[model samples]
Target: MRKTFTRTILSISFLALMLTASNGYAQQNNTNDEGAQHLVKWNVAALLLKNYSFQYEQAIGRKTSLALGLRFMPKSSMPFSSVLKNAIDDDQTWNSIKDFKTGNFSITPEFRYYFGESVFQGFYVAPFLRYARYNADLPFHYEYQQNATTTVKDKMDFNGGVDTFTGGVMIGAQWSLGKSISLDLWIAGPNYGFASGNISGKKTLNSMEQDELRKALDEDFKDLPLVKTKYTVDGNGAKIDFDGPWAGLRSGLSIGYRF
Candidate 1:
């Protein structure tokens, strides 16, 4: 009976020691994992374009992570003088056009799967979804006749905006520089989506003038690769309703830092 009690006590003590050791090992692993998990990065390429973009990533498992990005570009305009000089040269017909203005904000979320050993480094594939809103204004010239003998020319502005939702897959490689800095290169990816928007012209004209201007625009834009377009006469000018497939190129060299 005494031998049986001693054996029981030894078994209980051994089991307690084994449980304690296992818990300690688990706590150490948890500490190591917490150190490896959180990362925040800013896209330097977006900054170079005068836009603010930031990315945050958190590891959910050994080979998977969730990333979120935000980008915003305040109202900005680019002059067309340089492009016109190269495209039209000394053609006076296109010289009156001024500049193009654009602005946008977007949010993108991606689920990333890293094939390498580390979380945010090496080759990865991500399926991402993006939501964006943008505004733009493009200026062009049109001709009208003020009287039977006088022909007048005026500059008109096409102003519009659109909201877009897109989903695509991205394959990219990320390399680390020392411990905290990294570089990301997106190879090539295809994204397809849809956008619906309204484009309005900025001109005050009579009904006959509006009809003539709409007709002129119809003739001018007939060759454009738009999916669908509808024109409506507004108070002074005209508004265009556009519904189309939106395609854009997505590739950039971004410098980042890991935290």
Candidate 2:
């Protein structure tokens, strides 16, 4: 999987560079340019989703530029609580997520080519590479058989994180907003890649309890689209390991200062 991901990234990056090199015809249409050589931008729309992001872009030539962006999300309650609860519709799943907390960090680098002969002007296509990490904590719930006829329900606290890398393209438009300011509208950008992660907890359990907990985990997440899952249960504790496809989107309004 690692090799595959690396290859995908190299392919996308090479394609972007090739396009930039082959765009010699655009050099003759440079009169449409009306922007500065450097820009600093903030995607304020991300504030609504609790994700703060910023970007710095530099014009490299008559119609191409390079940009890098960083995003950080402080630990907070998981967004869309009601929507997720209603979607799952399971008491056990609900119990685990009622107090769920999460945070994230990511970095993205992109190559942009403007259709109107300048950076941060008119329409543009951007091919980007993103690496993201997601941190989460929740209580895993399960049932344990105590004696001949007694059953106890309990929960184990689990915390862990996942990492992902993906490459994709975006199309957007930017317009100069006064002498030094610019407005960028990310029309739409969708990305796809692979992800793997582990979330585990410590709880001494007998063989019956371990089996029951394994079954509980399966029953809880069976509906999701995970490609594969591996559970480890031993004397001290248990762990849940899984890997699958990861997909994401990029679309927001940004305010920028050009100089």
Candidate 3:
């Protein structure tokens, strides 16, 4: 009787081990069939602004994911015309605005919450952070006494840029075209940040010339509501330091492929 009981117990143990192994194998196979869960996207609106932007997204859970983007604006694509047009007033000084140039690069990281059933599709809310570095030549005007009686006026080139850090919340929608393609649209969003840089003129100025330039800037930019200005006199020339609140609008459209 004892020998018969031992044989039955061994058979049951062997059957249970086989069933567990089969279930584990089936789970592994299912995951392999699902494939990679990531997408790569290009921003079309960025190209229109003469910038190249690329984004990558990966799924972390059923309703949450993370996205990272990189944007580049080469020196050749300097002088973003649209931005300059909006920032500058078309007054007498408008004609003085020349030699406008900018070189910038930025990185953005966003955390998203999807409302729809899929990870990268449907309406979503994302809070994003961006860091950027830039170099630019802004426009300025100055005047000096040509002689004992006559005064002459000319434009001065302000050469410098800023490093900026900002964060904001974005709400947008995305749709899938087929199994492999998707479109992303940014509706509207607000961003706020700070910038710090030096603005130095192309040529060195004497004490009298620096005073004249300061007076000119005060009058010309008094009505402009964007930046708070400070001036520092250096050995080469006077440097205008800008430290203030920055705000702007954000929107874009992108197409992506899933892999």
The TM-scores of all predictions, comma-separated, are 0.76, 0.79, 0.76
lDDT of 3 at 85: 62
**CA shift of 120, model 3, Å:** 0.8
- Model 3 residue runs over 4 Å out of place are 1-36, 76-92, 144-149, 222-226
- Give lDDT for model 2: 0.80
Best by lDDT: 2
Q: Which scores higher on TM-score, 2 or 3?
A: 2
lDDT for 223 (candidate 1): 61
Please, what are the lDDT tens digits per residue for candidate 3 over residues 1-259?
9999999988855744553454345444542223547889998988877789899999898878899989989864344555766787864355555456677898989998988655775678999988887877776655668689998776677788777788888897766655577677776667788767666775776776767777787776556577677876443666777777766666888898889
Best candidate according to TM-score: 2
Model 2: clashing residue pairs? none
lDDT for model 3, on a 0 to 1 scale?
0.73
As for candidate 3, its clashing pairs are: none
Candidate 1 residue pairs that clash: none
> In candidate 2, which residue ranges exceed 4 Å CA deviation?
1-35, 82-89, 144-151
lDDT of 1 by residue, 50-149 (tens): 6788888888987899989888998676444566667775443454433667888989898989886657656789888888888887675667777899
lDDT of 2 by residue, 1-259 (tens): 9999999989856854553443333344443235468999999999987899999999998889999999999988777887888899778778778788889999999999999745666679999999999888878877766788998897777788888888899998776645677777787889888888888888897787777777887776666673356778776777877688888999988899888
Residue 156 lDDT in candidate 3: 71
